[model samples]
Target: MLAAVALAFDMTSVLALMYPGRERVEILGQDGVTYVYACKPGPAGETPAAQAAKAQAAFEENATKFGEAFAAELMQGIEAGAPTLGMALDMTRKTDGWAGAITAHLEKTYGCALLG
Candidate 1:
């Protein structure tokens, strides 16, 4: 589940850093890590973590878009040997691996994701 946790951070960072006017942006690489978060003090002068505080607000405002984007990612393989961790994470959180509020909130959230 550590992989899932790492991927989750990268996923949220990738989405939060998306340029508002971008027509298209590449979030994750073939290695399953998001390139956006890997860069240091990027062209925009803001680190990915610098924007994390507003992520929940952004998602709340664009819930539909967020959900769609998330579903799209779920259809693709994010890690080697793990076609997708959606089911695994879901099951794990329900079983002995539950991690408390964070997992619970994520499981209850409803939103759509936009690729662009």
Candidate 2:
């Protein structure tokens, strides 16, 4: 995704998207592979990443949630201030309630309200 139009969040070396012009956040977790949270308008208001993921089969074996076609777009759409891979190394470790913990961290740390 383009750096000027997206927000990236992550936990445990995993990166997630809260793309620009979209009303939802997709938070992938190492604990169970993926943890998604979408806001109002639901599917109709999905981000490019979310739409791309839905375009493919759910949980395609040996393939990413978003197939190869979306890889480049996703890569290019990241916001300029989005966290880098290096930051993940120093990010919070996995906990029992990883989803909640990471969500809290994202909102509190980045001031980006995932739920809003």
Q: By lDDT, who's the top model here?
A: 2
**Residues 19-99 of candidate 2: C-alpha lDDT, one tens digit per residue:** 334344455543354534332232455454554344222323213522453444445545444466633432333222444
lDDT of 1 at 99: 32
**Model 2, residue 90: what's the lDDT?**
28
User: CA lDDT, every prediction?
Assistant: 0.38, 0.40
- The superposed Cα distance between candidate 2 and the true structure at residue 49, in angstroms, equals 8.5
TM-scores of the candidates are 0.20, 0.20
Query: What is the C-alpha local distance difference test score of candidate 2?
Result: 0.40
TM-score of 2: 0.20
Off by over 4 Å in 2: 1-22, 37-105, 114-116
Q: Give lDDT tens digits, candidate 1, residues 1-116.
A: 35544443445446645534322223443345442322222235544343322333443444455456556545543433453456567545544332344333432331112222
Q: Give Cα distance to truth, residue 101, candidate 2, Å.
A: 8.2
